[model samples]
Target: MSVQLLIAQLLLLILGLIGVATAAPEKILDHGGKALLALCVTFLAAQVRPRTYLKLAPYAWGVTLLLLVLTLFAGKGAAESGGVKRWLEFGPVRFQPSELAKLGLVLQLASFFSRRGVQNKLISVTAMILLTTGLVLLEPDLGTSVLTFGLGVVVMFAAGVRFSNIGGFLLALTLLALPLADRYLSAHPYILARVFGHLGRDEQVAVGLDQIGMAHRDLQLGGLWGQGPDAPRWTYFAAHTDLIVASVGFATGLLGVTMLLFAYWLIVSTALQVAQLATRVRPMRPEIHGASILASGAMFMIVGQALVNLAVAAGLFPVTGVPLPMVSYGFSSMLTMGLAMGIIHSAMREVYRAQPALADGL
Candidate 1:
């Protein structure tokens, strides 16, 4: 599973290199270097025990929350982001806490679910998800917000929490969100525009003239075989980050994109396999099995966010700026996913080491 996961990441990183090089040459070197650093972190994380990740889950989650809150007041983003505070700068490094929150919440939720007789487990998980989601949403990052929420939901359902219970909590959440609607109205015009415009509910907005429109044109220009690196294309903001798939489509064409999709399939499948192995090690309350929960949460987040990014680029969903994991050109995503991949590796290692008999399943 780790081998395949590595292969998948390498392929995606290569895709990132190609996409960034083609659309944003200035960012290619930085992208490559950071990707390498992230992979290094993953390899290093594998050296740690799975139980270590469990022990650290609470700390990780707490720190992530602190970061998320900190970002709201002190974070800064690219000029194109239109003053959205999503990143915190430190000396020479800056990153998005929301990205880190994805993995942090995953580990934290998994830890909570695994422990037996924890009171209000469901509510705890919901609060964690809500807090993380709310912060990202306040950043007005619709894409990461959806991804974080989806991660918690997947973990909750897998933990065997019933639908009715989920719905009840969701309703309560709705009540909480009702009062915050003005935040969206006052601070998220960009988000509202993308969503409403895509649905054709807004008549005054020129919907098709934005970056997404250019992304669509880039895809069409690539055709079945793609136009290669030298293709004539209009560069758009976030071509290397949010709209990377289209960049890949433009440079590599359908064939390249198909390969990219296959890479994702391999990755998601490998993650499932890892999760399966981990679950087997702790058949009863597998969530307590740190590696098992880690694998499961990581797999869901990867596939869920990947699907959203693909849908948006394919014109099936609104542009939500969700970066394709391992494939997007951003330090925060690269490092966060690197940690996820690393901890995932640790989980597999812990499982195999703890139960040598289970190694045969792999």
Candidate 2:
């Protein structure tokens, strides 16, 4: 991708994030740097062949896992807002290992599933899910953990695995997740509080559930044209980033939110088209479609996480602090997504090259 295109996209994303900046100029640079890194990493990844990517999967997973562990111990500590322990600092720069882990697991799983023999697919996918999910859950980042698991299952299904196994996996997973969910609710008082707040709990105000309530109210007030650009949403402290949906709703109303979601849906559909094209190629090998599978998973990771973040802002899901992918203010997230996009772009190029007719339009 040309620097011009990257710059343009970065600007659009920044314009949206600008609404929520506290310190204005400083936070913009911090976030912009991360976005630029994502773009750079993406271009680099796109240059590599799927086969080479497969070869590197094991190492990538290992390094990411190590970083997640180090984050638990030596992580530079979470940002000043709430101390979430989700970011790690490297000297002057801070990055989120969880974000990197998201992309890492997607690529690793694509490599893993692409190489699986039909007979061993069930066991192999199961093992990958267990290992990846365990590591992600340890990060205690529930949203990304859910996303990682979802990506693995989607790829396994696409690889022509038996539906019965997918069903069985879901059934068993439901059983396993039930207990975990119960334990989580028991331990995390805030989880239930958030849910209760969403349900219009009156007593929640004293316990700080008022944020959800206030956000919901703000959504209602954003009817039609909204409060206009850069409008204040007192309900959200930094309305542009974490509470973006509500932020947009407050400014542009329902129309802006609709457009944003539509853009995401379009990107996701494009990625699916790429995957379908790659899967239909002649002389098919697992490696041949590896890039496409990774691309599809990457799209899901971004779209799915963004939806979750939006849902939280809309008071649907409990807040997990996940950003709105390319639209959010965080630097690490922007860069990570740019990197993922670069990989997806690479896959698209490869798929197009295989068929000149399709290549022309792109």
Candidate 3:
């Protein structure tokens, strides 16, 4: 098997085992089925040529935008008890459009930047990014909104947008966001509670803080080798989802956590290397530059989400409902990640095919 496929499978195996140990039998079976479907989707996507993807990029973004609109009007509420509408239910299948929006935005931005006219259309590109990001924020998924925006920023940076321009835009955004946040927080006090609840003000906030503290304690209890699956003190909620890293720590200790992180590091390192190689080739194709940007953006999304999830699980950051990339039990997230990996693989294939000499040297 290729390194990408091998590492992905191993990560899925680890997550599957965690599901079986922590979740219901039927849920574990469902996770397995979804994972298999994701693998098949990824396999098919990997076969798509770079030219085909470019042809299909606009349609994909249209569909993604349409889904976001549908979600805004008729989407289901949060899986847990909350008023947020982030998922769309089609018969028995439910998925998050915001997840699809991530890729759509990345591809659109990559295509926009790969062309020679990027320098003249910065305003238009920024408007597009803000519009899509605004729609996501309306989903009331603060985490996904922030992530999508950050990915856009990274893509622009990779495309050689100046630091002064980026900084000025961010400053203006922050200034505009402050009043909006204050107004929104005034209406929805619970949001503020999540941010400042550790201060012992509200019951819900206290419970959230307590959960973080307990997660910390659980990690301490695991020590170097872990307490195994049947440990009596494993009390963290969402142990198989947002808190999977904590679950791993409780069951397999720091060693398992380290190994899991190392796998993520390897995947990201390979992606960056592929992107660098794509950039280093002489007389590079425009499509290759676009592919490199796509690969880098995908890596940032996966690695960034993993880091955020780990920070939340470790009680070092505010709870953002971010799931660990391959380890978390969300079908939408899994499918999105699978598609990203496939795209990266396709990009790598194109790079190597364009430079047979480089391929031979590797």
Candidate 4:
């Protein structure tokens, strides 16, 4: 499809969702952020040149790294919840540098692979992971840390990391992570409670049981067609962002949830198709830099984060305050993700288009 048509569809879907959610009016401003971000993304889609992105990657990575350092030194010393410092206040707006870092890291890796086949792409990727993850972990933003790290591994995998190596790395990661979880659980009562709940421990289950119990109540309240858009998800107060799927379940019922899932599946599937097509041709093969691999990476980052956030809201995992991509109510998340989508869209625009022959030039 043409880029303009694609952008229109995205705008329609996003705006439609926001309008639907606002009918009952929980947090309209937050949903508006989605629209605002999409607008910025659309503009960026037209402005950025693909070749320029190759040069921008190094600067992007450097700036992201510098932001990470600034967060440690001057970020809001502590969030309301704990020692985590994910936000840096710019008078009125709070910025999450890690979000930018996720994109920067992707661009960096893409640029590296586009140049020469690096024998140790995995090692280079891991170094980048540690640099970003270490900074995020210090902020105690475990959710973004996991998301960013996961994105890095995925990009490396796309660059053709051996499966055997991936297996070993994952195993090592699992071992290292377990002890951290254990230490965290030991250090914080809330962490212990959450871990215990996740582990199905009876004692700590009640800490968050009210939300679960209420969600079930909301589920039962919704019949086949649902309570309708006018129905308010008051019981699920965090519904608009963190527990949005539950809100959909409550307000629009199971069918709405099914449709939402189907829609995203379509988006991701379309991305995969573009990637696959890009992998086949030659003149525009490098264009695949923004297509299959980077597109896949972006989808993974967005969808993966949504699933994790949803799982936490469902009490399947400990709450980590991660927002649902495109659906969530955060300026940084919406805009950054929109920007990343624009980058991918630019890649797709050139994906199957015929490139000018080199000899024909002159």
> Among these predicted structures, which one has the highest TM-score?
3
On lDDT, the candidate that comes out on top is 1
lDDT of 1 by residue, 328-352 (tens): 8889888877777777677666666
Clashing pairs in 1: 114-287, 114-288, 137-140, 226-253
Q: Per-residue CA lDDT of candidate 4, range 1-362, in tens?
A: 33543543364345336433733365675566566766677567635655567667889898999998898888774444565567788888887898888888888877776665446646666677778877877766767888888888887777666878878888887887787876755554555565666666756466554565565566566666578657655644455656555666666666666665665565576566556666655754454554556666766776677678768766677766687666665677777777766766665555545342321431
State the displacement of the C-alpha of residue 320, model 1, in Å, after optimal TM-score superposition: 1.3
lDDT of 4 at 94: 86
Q: Mind giving the per-residue lDDT tens digits that candidate 2 earns over 243-262? A: 66666566667776776776
Q: What TM-score would each prediction reach against the true structure? A: 0.90, 0.84, 0.91, 0.84
Instruction: Score candidate 1 by lDDT.
Output: 0.79
Question: Local error of candidate 1 at 315, Å?
Answer: 1.3
lDDT of 2: 0.68
Deviating ranges (above 4 Å) for candidate 4: 1-26, 77-79, 172-190, 200-205, 283-287, 354-362
Alpha carbon lDDT at 233, candidate 4: 52
- On the 0 to 100 scale, the lDDT of residue 247 in model 4 is 60
lDDT of each: 0.79, 0.68, 0.75, 0.66
